[model samples]
Target: MQIIKAVYINEMFKISKKKKICTSLIFLLLSVIVAAIVVYSLNNFAGVSVTGSSEFSVMVLTILSYSLFPLFTAFICIDMFAGEFADHTIKFTLTGPASRLNVFLGKILAIATFIASNLIVVAVLSFLFSLFLNGGISNPLRIIISYIMAFLPIFIFALTVVLISNFSRGTTSAFMFSIFVFLVFVGLSVAFPQIKSFLFTSSFDWYKLILGSYINVGKIFRIFLILLGYGLMLFAAGYYLFEKKDI
Candidate 1:
C-alpha cells in the first residue's frame, strides 16, 4: 500500500507538471486577481468605511476559490484515469503488485489531494488580501473553517469523477459519462433546493455557505456527515468494481 501510495503521489506530480495543469493554475490565478480587484475596487469606490470583517467579500472570495476553482479541476480529473487506460499505461500499473483496488484508491486520493491543496492556496491568498482590503479579521478561525468547509462538496464531486472513470470501457466512454455525471451533479445542485432542502448548494453559494453569517454547528455537522457518507459510498463501489475487474 505504501509503495502504491508513493508511486501514485509521484505520478500526481508528473500530472501536475503537464501543460493543462499550468493552464489551469493560470486560470485560477486570474480568477483570484480579478476577484481581488473587484473586492479592492468595490471597497474603495463604495466608501463603505473599512470596519469589521467583510462578510460579503469573504463570501465572494469563497465562491471563487472553492466553487469555481474546483469545477475547473473536475475537467482534468475525468481524463486522468481514462486517459491512462486509453493509452494502456494503466495496464502497466495494474499488473504490478498493487491490486486494482489500491490503484483506484490511490488515484482518488491523488485527485482529492490536488483539489484540497488548491483550495488551501486560495484560502491563503484570500486571507492575505482580505486583511488588507477589509481592515479586520473579526474571527480568523471562522473564516478559515468556512473556507475548508466550502470545498467538501467539490471534493465529493471530484471522487465521483474518479469512480466514473474506472467503469468506463474506453476513454471515449469515460469522457461521455464524465460529461453526463458532471452535468447531473451541477443540475442536482441547482435543483435540489426547489423541492425541500434549504441546505442545498443551489440556495446559497460559497459566500452564503460561509462568511455570509454563522451557520449552526448542528447543520455543519450534518453537512459533513452527509458528504462523508456520499464520498464513502462512491469509493466503496469503485473498489468493488475494481476488485472484480479482470485486469
Candidate 2:
C-alpha cells in the first residue's frame, strides 16, 4: 500500500512538473469564451433569448462535453502514457519499488484525477460564465446531474487511449492510432446511426438524458452499463499489455 501510494505521489509530481496548468487554463478560458459568444450572438442577432434556458445550458454542456473535452483528454492521456514511454522515461519509474500493478494504478489515478478535475472546472466555469452573461441555468440540478454523467465517458476515453498507448511503439504512433480509432468510431456512428446507444462516443451527449422533460431511466442505465463495461475492458487490456511488456 505504501509503495502504491508513493508511486501515485511520484506520478503526480512528474505530471505537475510538466506544467499542464497553462493548457488547462487555456481550455477553461476557451470554453467560457466560446459559450459566452454563442449565447450572446443567439440572444442579440437571432432574436433568441436563450439566457437561463435549459436548452442553452444543454447546448453549452453538449459542445463542451461531446467535442472538446474528449479530444483534450486523449492528448493528455497520450502524453502521460505513450509520450513518456517513447521518450524512454517510464523505464526509470518501472525500476522503482512499486510493482507493475501499483505503477499502472498510480498512472491511472493521476490521469483520471487530472481529467476529472479539468472537467469539473469546465462545468463550473461554464455555469458561472453563463450566469454572468444573464444566461441563467434553468435547472442547476440538471447541470450537476449532466456533469456527473459526463465523467463516465471521459474515463472510458482515457482508458481506451491508455490501451492504445501501451500497445503502440511511439507517442506519434499512439496519437495517430488514437485519432484513427476516433475517426472510425465516428464513421461507424454515421453508418449505423440507429445503434449509437451501444457506441461509447454516442454517450458523449449522455447528459441530454437529464435535460429533457422526461428522464429515461432505462436509457440512462443502459448508457451507464455500456461505459462502465468499456472502461473495465480497456483497463484490463491496457494493464495486461503494460504488465507483460518489457520496459
- What do the candidate models score in CA lDDT, each in turn? 0.65, 0.80
TM-score result, candidate 1: 0.80
Candidate with top TM-score is 2
Model 2, runs deviating above 4 Å: 49-52
Clashing pairs in 1: 59-207
**TM-score, model 2 to reference:** 0.92
Report the C-alpha lDDT of model 2 over 28-137, residue by residue, as the tens digit: 67877877888788887997876444545556667776566777778778887788788888889888778899999998998888777877787777777768766466
lDDT of 1 by residue, 1-247 (tens): 7977776886687577778777776776677677778766766898654323455345555466435655565566666676776677767778778767677767777777777777777777766666676655677776766666666767776766667767777767765776676566557766764632323333224324444556666755666666778778877876776566554
Error of 1 at 68 (Å): 3.2
Point out the worst 10-residue segment of candidate 1 by lDDT: 195-204
TM-score of each: 0.80, 0.92
